[model samples]
Target: MTVTELAFFVGASGPVTAEGTEVINQAIEVQTEWSTRNAPSMPQGRENRGVSFLQQIEDPSVYLLTAHWASVEEHNLCIAAPENRETLSKIPPYFQVDKIVYFHLKDVAINSTSGKNGEISILQSPIISVGRLTIAAEKRQAFEQAWNEVKGILEEFVKPNVVKNGWRLEKENETTEEFVLVAGWPNLEKYRDFAQAKDFERYQSVLASFAQTRDLKCYRRIL
Candidate 1:
């Protein structure tokens, strides 16, 4: 039920940098105010969620906001609130949000070398991957076998640049039969090259043979 992450990507068309920052800062303030004021009524054990924004180094026009929520019901309640609605309405003039994508994060790795009191350093920031695949009832085994092969390549040949990587099967409660891959990378260029490589394409072909439907995307942390 946890909301591991909710990512909002700012699109190409939007206000200039200074204006966008102003809008984001305002949104943060409003969200914080609302959360605090409604804490008593908010779902128990879910009031300590956090949000942050990250900007892509290669593409300044694109930025991401990631929020961690306690549960799906809490997220729904927050979105449906009148104050939250008002806050969302005021954002378009300053920023264009592509889609509010949701994810359930799996913590693949954490480095505790910093040795500070509860001050863990993020050696590599989070990366989010979203995808959906066709699932055939009778061909599940075949599909799994193919996926395993591709995963092997990913682990051996593709994951060196990834500081950490892991995949999760989606919940039956969701609308789509989506599977998510979460990874952390030292650099985006390395992940970009790995995705477009010939070997990766070959891996995809192998997967496509068994998949009747497919959707895929890759995202880097901006906030």
Candidate 2:
């Protein structure tokens, strides 16, 4: 799957306000509505599998749109259409254009999907934890090795939930530092508790140390 991630951060000059956020929500809803339509401009045999709008838990002003496509070519064709391009352009006012991280990810490897309880699977998990680690280009191999080795260590923290956590590389980007990490959990409280624990830092230290910048945020699926 070609997963396209678009993180929209709050505009620098504009103050975060309820009215402005409502406008932003309405603008994004337009894109969501368009993706669900069966329009001729859409590729013949390909269609979007899912399009979700996620609100950042720590910062309500930030939002993420995760869209799943069959391939990069299909994704390119869809957005190049005039109408779809215009639909996407409606969202820029709500975000800092330069800060937005728009990229594609491939070769995703996530953990088991069985729920923490019984029925609530990873997809059904209330929070999706996304961590973007910007590694120094030279440290890529060491970073990947360190992260891969700690998967078992991470699993130890999964007391109840499915250990649906793994990493993926960017499918298309000029820079090589885009390593996207994802995990699933029931709520913010559970994640925060574990994040503060020494075990998490034990596994996370090397990964963070290798990266020039690390951004970690938990998001609630709103789509």
Candidate 3:
């Protein structure tokens, strides 16, 4: 099973600057270098794979990095290594380590034979996804139709392996209703291509008239 870790970079006291950027880069470099060299010698589960970085629009200073792993043990090993220990010592200077959350992500679509309801064994962590939508009151039905149609298209046309899990919720956050899609792939390249595929274009077209904008976020899971 594939595991995930969400790392959040929250500035401890001041604004992030050029100096701060360099510091952060150096820290990552040191940590990654050490992990690459030491992972193989560590216990079976704690080896290092690589980290996938992502940042949201709300705050540029605040960043998210997701590190994928062959297994939970390998993920744990990398974090506990000596290089990561040294890097941790430097984190407070540039930013505070908010918290580290861990997650055992499951492919809900693959496990769902009927595709009516998805069962996600989500680990209790900080990597929760929230989406907000603004739909006119008079066009509520129209909005729902659009969302469902797009979801149906995604389910039918896109390859099942491309999507890990899918969920639909009404009034999930405030006034927004969203159909959420989750995917787990060997690499980001596969997901990026499918997002730009023709079928995906058609799915988005269904919601084009009613959608104001779609906000997306990818968070690292830390526990």
Candidate 4:
């Protein structure tokens, strides 16, 4: 199972200053080394598919770290290992550890169109949206069923703006009923114009029918 770790962080003192971001980057450097290293720590080591740093489009101060892993069990094992503890301990000075919240979602392939120089198309895309969709408690199965009804229709409705789109399942233990939806787009204008378009009316209604609340924001990858 492919799992993607999403950690939301803010600066300890206030909005992260330029210098604070630099300090955090330095710490990330250490974590990067530990993540990429070939070591004999665990029986079957964790897989670090790729690491990304994202900044909120509306507010640059809010930071997010996205990491891909093999499974949640493997992720827990790697993070708890003594080899990685030192790096974790250093994060508090630059970020508010108490306020940090995370969710590890089951990720689908976020790859690109094949080419001579292929890459993760999502990262290269101008902006991506990470949507936090909350449904009624214990309504995971119901929500998926509802979405399946409109998935194909809405996919076509959104058109080329939604270059790639999929919902990442939030584990049962993480939250009562939440799905992390990731959408790749070339620009924000095209994405925002969805509401004004007459075609989106019915689909939006279908979407709102199942979703209790949605907190979605555009983000650009900085690292």
TM-score of each: 0.57, 0.70, 0.45, 0.77
Rank by TM-score (best first):
4, 2, 1, 3
RMSD to true structure for each model, in Å: 6.4, 4.9, 10.8, 4.4
lDDT of 4 by residue, 1-223 (tens): 6767788987776667666666656556655555556433422212234467778887766788776666777667667767567667767777888888876776544433334343335555677777777776677787777766666554454444343334455545555677666766668886787678665766677668767788889888776
Best by lDDT: 4
Clash pairs, candidate 1, are: 53-223, 54-222, 54-223, 55-222
lDDT of 3 by residue, 148-184 (tens): 6666654453343333332232243555444444433
Give one digit per residue, the lDDT tens place, for model 2 in 147-218: 778766655564445444333444344455667767677777878777676567768777767877788888
Which one wins on TM-score? 4
In the range 1-223, model 1's lDDT, one tens digit per residue, is 4454545456537424666666666666666666666655532322234355656545555555555445545556777878777777766765655554544444423221224353322323454343456555567667667777676655444343332322333355433333444344445565676666657887778767766677554555433
Error of 3 at 112 (Å): 22
Sort every candidate by lDDT, greatest first: 4, 2, 1, 3
Give the winner by TM-score: 1 or 4.
4
**Total clashes, candidate 1?**
4
After superposing candidate 3 on the true structure, give the runs of residues whose Cα lies further than 4 Å from its correct spot: 13-15, 38-50, 98-223
